[model samples]
Target: MSDNKLWEGSTPFKEKSHLFKYRNWLADNRNIYFNSYEEIWQWSVDNIGDFWESLWDYFNIIAHSPYKSVLETTTMPDFKWFDGARLNYSEHIFRHAQLEQSAIIFGNEQGDYSELSWKDLKKKVASMATYLKSIGVTKGDCVVAFLPNVPEATISFLAVNAIGAIWSSTSPDFGTESVIDRFAQIKPKVFITVDGYFYNGKPHDKTTVANNIASALPTLEKVIVLPYLKKEDVSGFPKDFIDIHTIFKTDGGELVFEPVDFNHPIWVLYSSGTTGLPKAIVHSHGGILLEHLKYMAFHNDVHKGEHYFWYTTTGWMMWNFLQSALLMGATIVLYDGSPTYPDFYKLWAFSENVKINHFGTSAPFLVASMKNKIAPKNNCNLSSIRSISSTGAPLPYEAFEYVYKNIKSDVWLCSMAGGTDVCTAFVGGTPFYAVYPSEIQCRALGVSLYAYNDDGQPVVDDLGEMVIDKPMPSMPIYFWNDPNKERYKASYFEHFPGKWRHGDFIKINSKTNGLVIYGRSDATLNRHGIRIGTSEIYRSINKIDTIEDSLIVNLELEGGNHYMPLFVKMKPTYKLTDTVKNQINGLLKKEYSPRHVPDEIIEVTDIPYTISGKKMEAPVKKILLKMPIEKSINIDSMKNPESIDFFLQFAKQI
Candidate 1:
């Protein structure tokens, strides 16, 4: 692909004053080697040593000792970044504490607004830190938070990291079993939770769930509860259970920041394991800091001091990624309810009131809005949004077109896809690229991504397995319970030998320099010796407004031959009539092929989704086949798991 195709925009974003400032700084400072994004990306691949060292230097990384070397010569997984560097994750985020800039912009579905300036946020974190330290939460201890995307949650996270304690969190809606399953393994010293959460105009009390988890785990010493609703009974806490507002008296306290090594664990992220148990993926301080900085600065083009908002939860990787904007001194807008609550135009209304610059959400949400025939253009002003990122699933062409016609035509539509294993993206949107209808703009800079065929050889034109050729800085340090690394190996490397198989089936359009991700490669349908992607069908079926949402799976009949079966949830205002069904089949046949249309179309009320918002196709398939579904890794956001039964009944009848 030519450079022109990669960069087709009439206005050069690189020449923008704010973007050019970094380029000019790089050129003036001979200490930093790279002069441009292309040069830096190439150097990061060539000299892996000077590249990361320079990246740390260019970003003014606060480290105790400059590393002896950038990387070690060894196996891909074992190689380390910043071998001798020592730094604390929390200190970097608090670097601009004394400034009067904005830190957090918070609101709910009810239009309630709250703002936290940098100075106030710092003071709150400091006070919380003092309270935590007074309670004996010292270095190397775990602090788990069960809260929503409110200020208290962010403050508690910062407070824990400020005192050299590891932080982990999940949304308050997590069930008692799901909460205990993961937190019990860590044996946290303190538990931070909210009394209740308001979602879609309903209140869900989390105190009972918190008490149940606390009872199961004996090591929990303190339970700090914030009263979002009226104070509820502390079910299992001792006499020492206290309210958060009572512990922290003053907003200002001397911030005692602890310094630690680069490789010290920062966040314990969990991955949903399809087989039985979820894997606790541990990410290091420096790895997450540097990787997020690079992605925000170069790929996402996050301007400093701008308001950045991504609708996600603590259970999702985007929540972690969105928090990194604070490291860049950017104000973060956090919302904690359904985007379509009360109406489909809620998100756009919130964005208009907050004046968000960069907005991030999932493709499924947009697809639903398009099917419902709701356009934000009539309800809200989305003029301030410059970039719109869609992830958690592939962005279908119709959804892209909907955004262009209904949202803003000038915004960059970035369709990014990555998983919880790395907590980073492999393919993402770039500021210098044009928006493609159904493709990710480019491979993430510094990530050596390539498509490989079934034979383990690299392929170009056709669809193949997506794999990373080199080890990036954000690779997980270790699996929490897998000491032997056997489970880790089986998770990623077992599919292909030394290469890191990412489990995404993708096709690269060499002509346009674009990439299309199908659903997970493990779920790819193979019929008559031909493999096909499920997104290929949904992408076509979703364009019709009659279908609200849909799920496609490969079905095995009595003869062991596989066929495609589709389950669709019609729009609330419409029913699945003969005309709608025929229109869907006609569109699928005309756009895709005969094989793309499902042999069976079943109407359903809802589709099963993981806590992180990805559709749960594997478990649905198991339910269709009358097999047992392993425990849901996280069931916080699940609206209805029992809805799968209706789809199974339909499939069995067919």
Candidate 2:
């Protein structure tokens, strides 16, 4: 493929690029010589110890006890990073805090905005920490939250980490069973939750869910509730529930930062759990601290005093990633309510209102905006946006073009691909590289990533499994309650022994070295003995004007027969007629192959997506095969669980 340079780094950006600065530092201090980014990347991976040591010095990581070695082992799952280092993740965050700067700026879909200065944030965190300590909470205790993306959630996380406690959280929208299935595995001592929340301009009372969760988890010593919607009475809550304001009323004291070991658990993140219970993946303090320092500074080019915003909930890993911006001295912008509520232009208007320097969102949001014909350039002043990051799914080429045409032409539209597994992007954009349409700029520094064929050999210019040949600092330390390391090994290392198989179908361009992610590998569609990515079909279908969103599944019957059905959610004005079906098939045939056409075309009210905005293709395929709905997926994890009803009825008819 040709080099489709959508945006090039400006002269000012080149001067400020972290890659350039790091190169200059290397040449000045270490006497290392590198001419290009590829050389630098190769050097970083080859001399892993030196590269990480340089990062520790470059970021001035505040470690109470210095590491004896940068890496203890290079093994995949058991790789130890910065062993013997003792540091607090929250301490690094507070180090960048200045009294005048805003640590967090928060808003919701209702246009309510608030700011918390660094000093105010520290005071709130200190008060909460003191309260936790008073309640007998100590180091290594699990503090799970069922809160919204509010200031309190940020403060709770900071307090939990400050005291060396592990933090885990889910959005308030999660159902009782879904929340229990995750939190019960960890058995958190303190449960922090909200009484209610608003979405799509309507208030949703989550008191029942919280009550049920509190009842089921016996280990919860205290349930602290925040009044978010103010519609419910706290008196109706369980007797064990306590008002969060009471905790804040405590006299504030100096914040205590507990220095934990390098591999100590800092937080517990969960997998989608479509097949069964979500895996409680654990990440460490030192691993996450160093990884985010490299990711935000070098890859994202986020700098001090800049405003960084990501449209995400507390449940998503991006929320955790967004909080790390505090370590860089960048103000994090938080939004709690629906992104498209009131209008499709809400987020763009929000970007302008806060003067967002770096904006992050999913690919589906951009596609929806493009289909809705909402042009931000015509309505909003987006001059402050220097970079737009897209993740959660593979960005279609049309979406990439739409961003430049309708949003802002001079911005770096970085199409990134990674997942909750690492809590960071393996392939993303760097300021030194030019933005290529629909392609991740390059492999992240310190991530030894490669596309490997089914035989576990590396390949280029062909779709294969995305694998990490060498370990990185940010890989999950272990899964909660997964003793003997059985589940942890089965998740990634089972597929290819000693290598981290990420389970994503991807290809690296031979010419540009840029990465293009197809859909999930297990969800790839096969027709006429030829394997094809579902994203290829979605890319073609999204070009049609009538279709808003779609889902496709391929089935192999017991007999020598195969079936492929295409389900589409159409625009309000359009109908699924023969002409539209023929148009879709024709586009697939012309752009892809004759085998790419679906056997049947149908219309649906909605498409099922994970709460984090990923298509539920694997679970939907199981539903089509007459699998039990409960076993097929966790309904609470879906954005629109009602959408699954259409597939259930269709399955009965078939």
Candidate 3:
């Protein structure tokens, strides 16, 4: 790796960080001291139970009852954490209600802005909770929302948790079938929705979509509609529909947090549903409370009263994660429209206007901005921004360099990788470490992350499966409707037997202790007998200005023949000429090996992505491998469902 340090934590900056204070707390309270992050991380993973148990006191988590053991079990599919402790996730969120900063600040594509103060937020949550209970919803009941990334969604989630009902949501941009595939499985008692939303300067009316979704779920008792769109009313909705304004119209209810067991389900996050019905991964209230507190407080180094913003829809896990900043008394910022609404620089202008301290976005957005040459530093006052967080995919080396060169010189850039399996990131950033190009700063404390080879041996400086030998509280309590958790076991445990084999292929650098993610192991481009990550090929492809996006898949045909083709989406003005193809091949061969070059390079209109902005390489591979179309991918879960049609027609030729 290059010896380039983009940013360094100074003496004062480190001293003021929450991680520094936590380190000091360990020295005083637990008699634990370490000079380096590696030492602290080692101690944490070595003593996983003690490390997590210490967070109970450090975060001062409010528990109605005390826990007996740090962890009750030690193995997969049966592991238990903090047995017998009773707490509430919503309760911890309200602890910061007394802060002077606004609890939620929202902006939309129509240039509309609004703020919800802590006092107002508490009142609305109480009102919504009262409405929920009035409709016979109670502890363990499910409440789902078809809403955007607005304050109302936050209010609805808090209210559901306030009364002990489970919460799930999808951004209204999702198709009706996609929403039904998720919400119908949960059998929600209350369905919350918005009439519509504005995106890219256009109005998307989902009133009909909401009614269709509500009608499909026979279990839904009440439908609550928020009249968000100026053009539409709830006139077309089904009967028993209640306006959200009515709930707030009679607002005299008191906010109450219902304490549940340590491992009780608080929210259900879904798998991409690329293949089948999305797996409803359930997280415990206490588990999420601990994980979020640790991640936001220590890893993010967020301070109270600071503005924290992540551009996301309610559908993505990052939306759930964004709200956790409020647990640290930071003002959480929300944006509802497309990131590139009038222009690519829309979010940067919003950052200037809102004075965002911590800016969070996907790696693709940063890469696209770099490609478009949209310089934020030239147009906006980004001096208030301290850290820029990127995830959703591996941040390329060039993208990391572009941020330091174009955005700001001294900003803390964090490149993290995690998935819906666990809402919190296994590997992310820490204040104790210096910023490294194209490397995740460190494995999160207590994550017990390791890269193991095909023989299940942990390897340093070599690529392997990302396995977790120990359990984190944040790991899913159980998947909804997964009998005996068979699907869950088959998803994570079947590969490594007691260890969780996260699908990603990653390597931990022996010298820097930094991790570099290659790509998903399931989608590895196995060239003949030599295996390499698709990212290794994409790394060279991204450098070619002609290619906008690409996907590579290896098809194992009969007689052990391998056909790996690279499908690239060209820029509007460029065509896939012979020179462009040769440029792509020459770079891949030069950068990696000749094996990195694809057998064929083809052009496509667009590449398919999950609704949450992930490359759909595995699903596309199945389609081209002659799997039945319906079983191959759930089209509703795709960002561009039409993009899959090109592969379906090509499948017959194969």
Candidate 4:
């Protein structure tokens, strides 16, 4: 293996360290038992017990009833990990609650900074927990929250989980219907939300939606409103609603923490459910905590006291991932509002001021930034940033080059891909390997990730369904309402029983051995009996200099003729001129199969996207088919919903 191409012409940095840091232990010890990736995987399969047991030790995972056995693996599907482990997920995080250390460093697009010390954060969390307990919130109960990416949101979740209460959240943008579809199923007893939030210089109201959700969901007993934007008297708040300030009353005692099993439920996240109603994927505390700690420590090289930030909302999984930094004793930078609002260098300015260590964001935002011509070179000092991780879409290889050339010469551009299903990524960053553009470094160390063919046999260097042959700690214990595991099993296991079939169509690169997530397997377009990933088209389309960003979906015509339909959102200052459109078409026809040439290249002001920032190609495809989008369709969180009309018009023209 060569290290020269790893950084892609970047400056030399210490790729490996001998120091026995808790996070670097995995990298340090991999060579002891295995010489290569193959050996490491084989050893993991052969000695499943020793593998996870060593992982627990290496990561310094705190637990009670120390697992006498790492795993009892009779088969892959029915595999059990860390049997008989008891620990409080909150305890591991609360260890960093030293009075002097900074726990949260918050900023906004409007140039404001708010800092929360460990003592202050713990006190606030204790206060919130006290309030939750006063409202009869108990262990095993669900607490739903809709908030922005602010300190309050993170603290609220930690407080809820600190008491062994399940925490579920969505961004404030989600409508009442979308919120109800999810929280109602779980029957959450307490609802924590904000009065409103700020985005793109506009104030968005959540008071009505929060009130509606509280009323519709009979299981919801109370609503705690934390005023953010509008601080007027919330007299219109439902009778069931209570002010967060009221919870701050001194009628509180010392914070009480609850211990839970390894597999105890921590959160109930949801899938987009554009095809149907969203599936509530329940993730456990032990798995999420351990997985996050491993990735943050080893992969991102995050150190205690380092400033960590991810541009995301509570609706996205990364928001929860960001909260784990507290466990690692890192300061979290929570910025609410548009990443590029008011100015293009908003995020870069934040980084310069805060000295951010590891920064995470989505690919679509990067693409938009590139198209918008918002270069951070002139006005921002981004020298503090070490790792820049991108997920939520298949990052265009060109985007990687752009970041290196424009953002910083020496930076680890980690292109990660995972979903709300498992609460973490199956293919992401690893410090041991060098990176290639738009390529995930490797399948997670213990994940057993493989691209399976139609026959279900694993294949390499070819596009196939991304499957995991073994169960890892992060596998969801079950769904929210599903008691028999029917819904849970059917989601991932039905396609490949006992094996995790992550619906991604990806190819492990032959030359670099890095993984390329082409797109969703379900979104794969089959023409003339050949299956092609949507990202294949997106990769080529995004390469065109004139094109800003585009969404490609397989559109079935009235006569059952299906063709690739692409809708492009041009740069704010640039329009979809005829020459640009012609160039886009010519490139698609020449580079890919003629079928790949979209039947129509329609121009729209914006493309719809989920809260996580992935293009809403599925819903756009649905609307093109003339299907009525139910209110249950949570397009509320989408960056742009008006673009769906453009896509529909283009479908009709085709």
- Which candidate do you rate higher for TM-score, 1 or 4? 1
lDDT of 1 by residue, 1-654 (tens): 123221134556556623355556666775444444455555556666655665787789998777877778635566687888888878888885546778999998766789988888888889899988888999889999888888888888888888888888888767777777778778899988887878889888766777787788799888888877554455534567787877656654678788877788888888754445567888888889888887787777787788899998776788888888887778899998888899888889999999999899998888888878887887788989878888999888777878888887667777788878888788887665576677787777677778898888878778899998677788887878778877777777777766689888898777655688988886787756677888888887777766767888886768867767787888778787888778878987897677777777778888777777778776666666656444422244344656656755664665
Q: How high is the CA lDDT of each candidate model?
A: 0.77, 0.90, 0.90, 0.76
lDDT of 3 by residue, 169-192 (tens): 999989999999999888999999
Winning candidate number (TM-score):
3
Off by over 4 Å in 4: 1-31, 34-42, 74-77, 238-240, 249-253, 556-561, 572-578, 625-639, 648-654
Evaluation by lDDT, superior candidate among 1 and 3: 3
**Model 2 pairs whose backbones collide:** none
Model 2: residues with Cα > 4 Å off, grouped in runs: 231-233
Q: How far does residue 102 in candidate 1 sit from its true spot (Å)? A: 1.4
In candidate 3, stretches whose alpha carbon ends up further than 4 angstroms from where it belongs are none
For model 3 the local lDDT of residue 421 reads 87
Q: Estimate each model's TM-score.
A: 0.93, 0.98, 0.99, 0.92
Most lDDT-accurate candidate: 3
* Global Cα lDDT for candidate 4: 0.76
Best first by TM-score, ranked: 3, 2, 1, 4
Q: Report the Cα lDDT for residue 384, model 1.
A: 91
